[model samples]
Target: MAYTKHIPKKRILCRELQFVLVLLLGWLAPHSLCAQRVSIGLYDTCSIQLLRVCPLSAGYKLLLNGKFVEVEKGTELNFSSRGRMLICERAGNEYEPCEHIALVHTDPNAQFELSLLRPQAETRTYDGNLSLFVDFGRIMCLNLVDQEAYIAGVALAEVGAKAKPELYKAQALLIRTYLMGNRAKHLEEGFNLCDQVHCQAYKGSASKYPYIRQATQQTAGMVVVDAEGNLITSVFHANCGGQTASARDVWMTETPYLQSVKDPYCRRSRGANWKKTVSLNDWKRFLQSKGVSTERINNTGYLYRSETREGMYELPGGIAVPFRDLREYFNLKSAWFNVAVDGGEVLLSGRGYGHGIGMCQEGAIRMAEEGKTAAEIINFYFRGARIVKQQ
Candidate 1:
């Protein structure tokens, strides 16, 4: 412009288009980097009729029915359900019943405590906001929390507080990956996920464990993905005996990254080996229920030995029973076990403490103690999986 240069109309239009594109991208960048939020169903499995909530932070904006009210810090609010409405009482002031109640803290780092009064459940502290409503004649409590905070809490609940930072990081990655993959699991139930083992155990905030929060932050925005960039299932168990199981062997679904791997680290851990003895008659009856003939059961075909993990327990007449079915029937610790008839009881010697799929927590903890990085621990359990930042 200073040199008074002449420009063609098409050239000027192209430049303007480029500028607009740059502006558009810039505007979208912050949104892309925004932290994800999740609404978790707290005490999801309990029929909570009464709940008590108190703000641990400065204050919260209470949305009752359709009106907004400012609640000061440390104000304890009691909520009870009346058919389809939620009744909230603070101190001695009883407000009008609300169909919906939401506690929104203006501070991004707010904390709150929730306790079930009617059914009598342990009190739990959580980060972010709380939402409450009535459904199916019970009070439904939902925690709207930042995704990373939820992951940290889940990791703590899953792995406990005595893990190394690397182990915590590995668990955090898997938890986040699972959340991203299964976000819609409870969409019909009016929450993103439930605080139960069926989804992931989330007791509360991981504030007690400083290392857990640090590990979660270090691995923020990360998730495990397959070669095709799809999120891996990210399944884990307490222990795997001496080896992990394949998804095909356990769940009947073939997953490339979930292939079995010999794990040397978890053998000496607490959950490695266990033994349980059930009545032999009970075992035989269970096998009979699964179509094992009396002839096969009496011929000792039901007495099986598994030096390595097996998907099926074969009987004399070419009939096979799934190990998972046996595990469930017997309340066994794991499917990887040796079955033998000892006296009047069926002696079941089992290895591992869980389903033996994906990462083994004991093994990962050992790896972390041996200075393995979180990425290394994940790669060792999940073959050929990649840990990539979440989009």
Candidate 2:
């Protein structure tokens, strides 16, 4: 599947290179899906329509389940066995016979779409001619195995994984969610029979593909929870500005750390994306103003392992909170975490993106350049997570 597009390295009039990185994600079909056949309720049994089984209505189509029924448009569908298969089609469309349908949800051989986009972007709306989403490609490359090309996918699934532990409580929530959703013995057998992430993608349970096997191996027991001490099934975004909110608070509930951000990485990323990196002269002014040593600046533009965001404040517990979110959401207050850097240009030193988490995409690319598999790459970041054969 297609992912991101690299900007051409054309030499500008100056050596200061500037260009946007576009990120596009492609969805892969599930591996080894077990099929099911069941009858659908075209019309409620107690309804007036039930009295007439000669076909529901003039144009009302029936879907056995959610897949395509493949009955031609404006044509009368023929189905004698109501107990054999499902029937599904558009609400107002016609439903043909269930046997005509070959697949559901997606088709790998079908064509895809691409769009142009600018990063360090403003506004989330896309114009479509060629729109692109922005994300950190640095982390996805961290631990690869045998040179797999699923980098974009790694990024897509990972954004939610890395944010947890800090965002929610208890690792069991993730396990229960996945387990509850796919607990059939047939599904489990099918998992052992598949070869990609669309099935069981982790290391131990049923995944056999090396990279996905490896990812599953490493993060064997990680989950996120809410403030009320409940397990959360959904994941949300927009970097809670540092101090993550609980499900109730953010989504307007009282769940513990459910929908929250307990760190300052958001604004730092925002500052980097919104404002140019702090100027060396200005960085010093800001650091000196914050009681940090000017010597921390070194010959570089920023202090080593020091705060560089132009948009945060310390709260009652000495936590850093994002100031930009005061009005839209609750003011954030969380002592976020990150890797410590020594020295470099504020503009150049903090050049790459992301929270400097487990995997570094740019670093992964560099590792890939040096010859590392994505499996090995993922294992590097997720410490106790494992990669086991699910069978």
- Please give, for residues 1-391, the per-residue lDDT of candidate 1 as tens digits: 0001122111112343334323422212323556567778888768889989999888687887557898888899999988888999999888998877889875546999998999999889999988877777878787888788899999888888888999999998999889878876665566677888778888999987788898888998889999999999988998999988888987899999999999999999999999999997787888889878865357366588877888888888788889888887777888899888878888889999888889999999999999999999999999999999877
Give the Å error, residue 209, model 2.
17
Pick out the ten consecutive residues of candidate 1 with the lowest summed lDDT: 1-10
**Winning candidate number (TM-score):** 1
Q: What would the TM-scores of all predictions be?
A: 0.89, 0.27
Query: For residue 88, what is the lDDT in candidate 1?
Result: 93
In model 1, which regions exceed 4 Å deviation?
A: 1-33, 296-299
Question: Which residue pairs show collisions in model 1?
Answer: none
Worst 10 residues of 2 by lDDT: 138-147
In the range 166-240, model 2's lDDT, one tens digit per residue, is: 111111223323332333312211111111223222221111223433443344333332333333333322233
lDDT of 1 at 361: 90
TM-score, candidate number 1 = 0.89
Each model's number of backbone clashes? 0, 59
